[model samples]
Target: MNERRKLLLHEKVEVRQLEEGLGGSWHPGIVIGVSESCRKVRYDELLCDTGKSKLIESIPVTGAIEGLYQRPFVKSNYRGRIRPRPPSPEHFDVKTSLSFGVCVDVLFKEAWWEGVIFDYNEGGDERCVFFPDEGDERKFKLTDIRATLEWDEFSGHWRERGVWTLVSLAKEHKKEGHIFQLVKRIWSRLKVHYGFMKMISEWTCGAYCLW
Candidate 1:
């Protein structure tokens, strides 16, 4: 059954935060009470602050249907953790056949990361695709792949998220210098090795000439 139908009372959940300063964050919560129709629920919003979590009883407000309620989507993996949930896979329709070298966003470590499909197996009910990112190869179900797109800030509209294939994740990783650092380290090691070998060869030639 789907997540909505399977959600029951007392089950832990991660509620999406829509409020200011906490927008886009997924906060830990639990189903404390359920209405007769099951359309409405009273859940406790576990306030997460500085690695501490405290529960606050959900109270229904007048004329507000979304009061202290959420769609109980993914199960809560929170142990005093608060971070934005990855973009919903439902946003993109994967109708086309995924082939090798196709750039796609992968749900890795609870975040949508840029990845390229290297290998694929379509025999099973859920197609398994391999992505080798940062020298680590891992298999992911087809459902976990989303079309790579970037939000166009210049447009100033939510619907303007565009697919600029040439610079898919370039701007996003500018602040993260680890990739540049890794490349620099590899280059430094190669330079050191080359210098050492050149010095040894010169010394050997000089010794032979003197003999």
Candidate 2:
């Protein structure tokens, strides 16, 4: 993989959007043009709120690059289609038994991130959760934490802490399917613009090489 591969015009890439406490999220865009002797790129990013494309120009080349996957950073809404159903309150109560060192998934940037509870004040509503992968810790409400779960494809249910929860895994699977379909549509458009072989090469190499 080469980090020095020159970014060309009309390429699909993602721009990094940094957050205050949370590390960051990548938003997808298409290279529309280049400037400053090709040190910067002009691109169009989809507006999650308006359902329209917005043109952003002169983004540094280092800021915009290919992503691990060709999908938008959807917030709240799933592919701008529907909001994912939160874990049913009737099924499990996270707050009553919340404690330190308990494994849970916290909803952040519209996705479930695995983290372990590090501290919690009894009778308080928030708990400190540590995300080891990011080497970061943050506070979250009980409503945002769900029991750490693994999908059991064979039995078609979610396993909480290695035990069966009996909740259908269909919604999670459906969300994943929606993302795959959206990526396929974007890939088709890129192929038409860049041709199959070139698109494959650029995509496989990826913008992550720069970092």
lDDT of 2 by residue, 111-201 (tens): 5655656663646788877653354678888788766643321222444442111111222344433532343354445435544344332
Residue pair clashes in candidate 2 = none
Per-model TM against the reference: 0.31, 0.36
CA lDDT of every candidate: 0.37, 0.44
TM-score of 2: 0.36
| lDDT score of residue 190 within candidate 2 | 49
Clashes of 1: 0
Tell me model 2's lDDT, rounded to 2 decimals: 0.44
The parts of candidate 2 lying over 4 Å away from their true place are: 1-87, 92-96, 162-211
* Candidate 2 residue 15 C-alpha distance from true site, Å: 20
